[model samples]
Target: MSENTINAVTRRHWVLIACMLSMFMAAIEVTIVATAMPTIITELGGFSQFGWVFSIYLLTQAVTVPIYGRLADMWGRKRVFFIGAGLFLLGSILCGFASSMGWLILFRAFQGLGAGAIMPLTSTIIADVYPPKERAGVQGWLSSVWGVAAIVGPLTGAWLVQHFNWALVFWVNVPIGIISMLLLVRFFPESREKTDRRINFTGSCWLMLTVTALLTALLQAESLGYWTLVLSAVALLAGWGLLRHERYSGEPLFPLAIWRTRTLLAGNVGNLLIGAAMMGISAFLPTWIQGVSGGTPLQAGSALAMMSIGWPLASTLSGRLMQHTSYRFTAQLGSLLLIAGTAMLLILHRESPVWYAGLSAFVIGTGMGMTSTTFLIAVQNTAQFEIRGICTASVMFSRMLGSALGTALMGAVLNYNLMLRLPQYSDPVQQVMSPAGREQLKPANLDLMLTEIAHSLHWVFVVSLIIAFGSLLMSRLVPVQKPH
Candidate 1:
């Protein structure tokens, strides 16, 4: 190759690496908080509102992803990315100093808003720099970073919490975010689709309102029975209005033309289901370890690490294997493994061995890694270069929506089961229910109730199995193709 060509390739690779690292940092930040949540909640004294810390972040992130994606198509990727990184850093710093759970939740929303831009742009930038044939392997490398982050985030969080304070968990992101912002500004190329498109403020408002309502309904369904129904109806109406606006508006939030492709639609559906399952598992695993297996915070962190290990390993191997096989087959195989892994979760019980649970996580992670990266590759390959950003963003939005809904639903299920079972336990047994709650439930009659909490999680596992099967079914819609 010519010297100039080699220079271009080197620059592209460096930019890709920087963007991937940023994405990894954001992904890890979400999960790393899990290991330290118990400590944080105890300190902040807001166990009743613990779920909001995660849900609010997820909700804001989900709403902003598509908006950023659309904006990147209009303004530029580098500008949007840097703005996002700065916002993330600012939020992280504020989060570290939060004196109350409410403030922490608010700051986390800012963090999610910034994180909204990271993942979609990472994929879009990759597509911008690489040709179709070479993109799959590169995407796999990016996928592996998530695994790395998953493993590192929790272990690091646990250490910080043990040696320093829980606030360090959020503070640690400051340096990483600053470094990523500097690298992106220095190395990333500015890319945008030139257009005279005007911003659709009304359409954007409608879209936001629609999603906010829908997410609120889903998240608060169990808590506010009447409000759930009211919000659901309003959301449906607003969603219909948004669709109509998009269909007719000159510059829509998401171009209606992209939805015409079957690949994009199918990939997004599968991603939504997969996202729900993935987040549900991620959120619950640590809780299960601490509550059921009676593991320490560090041990719980380590068990979750198995998932990190399994995903990246499979992603790296799948990258090489994709060179010899088709995306469809790879995705199918991955989805099947996910189904099998989730099915195996049904065997997990309070009395089950810890290794067995870890094994299940590894299997599930591997399957997720294979299917997610492959689907991303498939969708990118199917779309035109100019519209790739929006297409990729759409898939990510679906995943976020799934994650938000899943976290909310799973939280409700866990709480419901706990409440139902808690009343039956004697004080002594209930005292062992949760490390955070142990002191409050010290009555002697709660012992039997504590044991029953273990069985209630079985219902959660059954729900997860249903979600995994849904993902499998959606995977079949992906058309099979041989390696080029």
Candidate 2:
């Protein structure tokens, strides 16, 4: 290779680093708020609308990911990425100044729209720059950022909220975003592939509607009984129509050919389920700690820090193992770990030792590290070079969808179980809950509620276990030979 070739490759590597850093900012922000949410909601005075703050962000992100991914392919990754980063920064600023819970939720949706673009495009850009054999190692580095961020995000968020204010959590993104944008503008090469293709506006609308309806049904399943059925039917119809449109359209959002491959379909389904489990645990576990363990915000945050420890370690280790073993075996081991970790949670109680809770979290994080990185590699290996971007984006889309559904569904489940079990308590118990409504329930009542919450959470883990087992089953479908 010439000197210019070497220089180009080196620059590309640095670009990947910069992109990954920006992605880490986004990922961390999502979880950092978890520990700080109690403080945020209390200050903002809207505990009733608390779930929407998270849900709308996820819903918008889920709806926009594929659209952004497709646009990146058509327009260019770097340009679309900058647009996303800018929007995310703007949303962050607005969120920092949000006066009410409703405003915060709405701003969060804006943040999600921007965040949706960053994740898929980050991976797509990596795929564009690296070959199959080297991609796993690069992905391992990216995955490590997620693990590191998870640990840092909550702890940092707690400290900020404790000493400063909840607004600092959103404001922190400002400098990170600015630095990432500057790096990309200076160091990253600007590349675009010009295509005469037009946007599939109709198909995009249908796809968005389908996703919205599906998520709405899942989120409201416990509340609006008849609306759930109506929304579900709408989702099914829209899904069917979208499929038909894509099959006939000359340029589809996602090519039907990708789904025809059994490996892609099975791997994506498993990814979706894993995403649900991961998000569910991440969102609720802190609440569980506060409820059951008599923990302060920082203490609850510390418990989740264990997951950050395990995830990156396993991700780096899995990258090395990929060089020696089949991706199938590595992914299977990860899936099994997920099942074991989640199953352990089924037996968890308020009296369970902190170390035990941490152990379960570590196991779950290890499983996430293994499965997430490996699945991305599998999708890249299965698809052709030209379509690699789309395939990779599709996997991410599945995970985002799963996460959205999981957060909403788990929130509803937790609420429902609390309601069901609350009636069993005596009048004194009811009086304890009356001050802050459910949020102000006494520690004893809180513990009682959390026991039921744990039961509800067990169902989540059981679903996750089934999903991980399913992923293990689908690992066989991945072709032994890597695609060219």
Candidate 3:
């Protein structure tokens, strides 16, 4: 009730708001930009190069996350956050001015590097500021931002493109990022004397190289073909070198202690599998609705929207549930839901209703929401402040890697099945995406296309179900957290 206490409370709220805003900007950035890309590509006139704008951004973000995590812990969250947010906002400004696809790709890379810092630090800073009892509830608010962004971002992007210029999609981040940065600068202050500032340049380079090569191989596997093998080899070499260097370094960039913590490791494993399942559903569900079930794009999208609905609702409940129960129990419940959801997916076919697909998506998303929050809270609770940033970033990195792996794995299965049944078509999925496209084909070709796609996707669903079971195993392996 005292004035200083009231001032402190206000400052914390402002800081939380800033974190939320920063998170929203990052979360919405992909969806909004994607919605506007068709218009931007038409204007920029490099349809071939536009994919790099997204791939480069993802590669940079994933690679930098662990590096930024270590840096944040060593330098301080506020300092690192400012650097990241500044880079992101600057990238946004530059993207708005970009006249060509190449320039946009380069600017988006800058944005990705900044995003690498912002994502993990938001949770880390919230952990730093709030007490244990209050942290989960506040984290719930952060979780909801993702759902809100998912629901709002594309719609906003469509409106912006319809009425105004496509550049507004990039510019929109400017005001939001500026407000977030100013709020943090005012409310969240840091001191150089409080941080270690120990730079591990060699280890950092090795880490970055490893992540870059690995992700490059994963992302470019299809396009690069045999060349991906060389990248994969380089990634393995870099990874081995990194482990050796970190073993003897006085201050390791990636703390070795993390591997020794069973609960933390299990939590991250759960996150990884959850990420795989998430990618499977999000990537394929809409395609299933459109290609397999003969639904429109909007109908496909509406089915997918069920995920955003389930996610926010479950996230709001997860913190309270975790507060009242053990993390193991909550995570296990989520895993079971994942199993149920993925099982539901197995029953879907060309004749299945869209609402049924939507229901399945909702259940899967609810599972993801519950497990993700539980894993994050448990990881943070287990780690001390000196290592919290790295711990949090590890979670993010795990999920990213898992998602990439999932995309590759499911794509392989789908492609394998498609090729086995229908060998002549190089782009069967695309051929089946629209009714008009299918109508142009012979009846024999259309029947084969639909049948193979449905069969291939069934295997993809089977893989997701396996991943759900793996998550359950990880959940059971998670040692119950003693309350903080």
Q: Per-residue lDDT for 1-484 in model 2, tens only?
A: 2212322555776677787778888889878887789998888898878878877887888888888877776777778889988898899999999999989999999998898888888877776676667677778787788877877887798899999989999989988888887877777655455568777998999999999899877765656688888999999999999989998999898867567887778668768877788865676666556555545556666777778778877887777667678677788788888888888877877677767777888899898888777777878767754465567778998987787677666666555655576657543223332335556667676656656656665666566666667667766666554323
Model 3's C-alpha root-mean-square deviation from the true structure amounts to: 2.7
Q: List TM-score per model, in order.
A: 0.85, 0.85, 0.95
Per lDDT, the best of the predicted structures is 3
Ten-residue region with minimum lDDT total, candidate 3: 1-10
Clashes (backbone N, CA, C under 3 Å), per candidate, total 14, 0, 0
Model 3, position 205, has a per-residue lDDT of 94
Question: Native-vs-model 3 lDDT?
Answer: 0.85
Q: What C-alpha lDDT do the candidate models reach, one value each? A: 0.77, 0.76, 0.85
Q: After superposition, how far is residue 96 of candidate 2 from its true place, in Å?
A: 2.6
TM-score leaderboard ranking:
3, 1, 2
Which TM-score value belongs to model 1? 0.85
1-484 in candidate 3: lDDT tens per residue?
A: 1212322444698989999999999999998998999999989988877678888999999988888888888777878988988888888888988999888999999889888988998888887777666666788889899888988999999999999988899889989988998998787766223554687999989999998898888877888899899999999999999999989999888677678887779867888898888888988998899898889988888888888778777877888888788788888888888899999999997899999999999999899888888888888877876788899999988999889888888888888888898899878889889667888999887887888899889999999999999998988866575335
